[model samples]
Target: MQPCDLTSTGGATIASRFYEPPGRPRAAVVIGGAMGVKQDYYAAFAQWLAAQGYLVASFDYRGMGDSRHGPLRELRADLFDWAADFDTVIAATLLRGGGAPLYLIGHSLGAQLPGLLTHRDRVAGMVSVAAGSGYWRDNAPQLKRMVLYFWHVLVPVATKLFGYFPGRRLRKVGDLPVGVVLQWRKWCLNPRYHVGAEGTPVREKFEGARFPLVALSITDDELMTERGTHVLVDCYANAPRRVERIAPADVHARRIGHFGFFREQFQTSLWQRTVLLLQGFQPSQETAA
Candidate 1:
């Protein structure tokens, strides 16, 4: 992997890494990172994809990780801004990889925003991992209370007094800009989440998905329940969609939560499943596990 930088449409410098194989690539994959998660978290998986003959690019959204500069309080970025960052990464990846097929691997919030991408037509397919509605009520019962507290209580207070989320100090998640946190909070409070937040434009954007889409819901994911997963997939009203629920036992483990899918530990078990999906061998619903 080599260090690189991409300039966003609005001129923000996006820090990224490129994983390239020596020969002509079979496909190109753009990894859209989860909220509050850095691009580095997906490095191992990107390298593995490159080894399989795919050119891969992983990047940080503005106001997070390497893209962040100065004070977080100064950031005016919103969700659309981050989606634009993903658009920039996609364009850069496509330019570097030539005519190879383009695939998107969206993790968590990464999975939610792809439908809004301006260059959606260029993408051949998408794999969404733990992508779900952030409605606090839809969360698993065990996590509902905490989810409510975070969205209703903490987010507002922190963003008000500090100008940004104090995620580094509170350790809830990484530090987030005020606009990103508040906008996300507003969406999660609504039953329909982002679809409700943006209304008609976003709904239409989601409806335009005609390409193959695979939604991966981890059975034991504490952050996103089965209902949450369904809420996400249902938004892509016109897509060729497949839903798969994977239990830890299927991958011979005791746990595989929201964040486990990208960990290097699953290189053999869970990651291979992603490889097959990207390669166009869609298994029967039950065969996905």
Candidate 2:
């Protein structure tokens, strides 16, 4: 693992790790989770990518992990910030000393970030593990929906009311900035605003229209529903998109949730499947396309 840095759109220094195989590399970028997630979270997946003969670059967003941090009250942690950070990482690392075809693999929010960049075509292909199209339709059981709704509403209100939301107690939602909270709310509440022609400017920008795309979903993802993964498939304009479902039993002991799919025991299977997909193993319908 090699340490590296890239400048964010906000002019902050972004810290990252690059894993190169023993031989010349087949380049790939691996993006992990949302705010508060560290690059170390995907370390196993990076190693797997390296083992597959690909140079993997994984980074933390500015203000997260070892990257530069600003006043929590002042930073606007929006999805746009993620998109810009991804673009910066690509420019500084993957495209810096160009090698083999570039491929992108991201999980959860990381999956969403790649779709927003302007250079999707430059990439050889894309792999989205537990990817979401922003619609949380499968978040059923009215009580659960209410809980998520309350966090979506109250967290942002709390952040604006008091410079930072009391994050230590709530962990997930509270740690984010008001802008980021609002952006997520806008995407989740309105399915039409999440992807494809009906998506927001950010979603439209990242739409995988021309690239070969792969979408993978775990059966028991607590944070994202199967429908969220379906949204990704339906929204992509790519004619050759591939969708994969990893059974819960296959990843049981690993506790492969939305975040764990790119970590631990699931890493091997995920990487192997991704390598096969990238090597032209398309679903029957997409085979002729």
**CA lDDT of each prediction against the hidden true structure:** 0.87, 0.66
Model 1, 145-225: lDDT tens digits are 687789878998988999999998998877999999988988888898888878999999988977688999999998898
Off by over 4 Å in 2: 140-143, 165-168, 196-208, 251-255, 281-289
TM-score of each: 0.95, 0.84
Query: Which candidate's TM-score is highest?
Result: 1
Model 1 TM-score, all chains together: 0.95
Please report how far candidate 1 places residue 13 from its true position, in Å: 0.9
Q: What is the lDDT of residue 129 in candidate 1?
A: 95
User: In terms of TM-score, how similar is model 2 to the real structure?
Assistant: 0.84
Best by lDDT: 1
Model 2 has an lDDT value of: 0.66
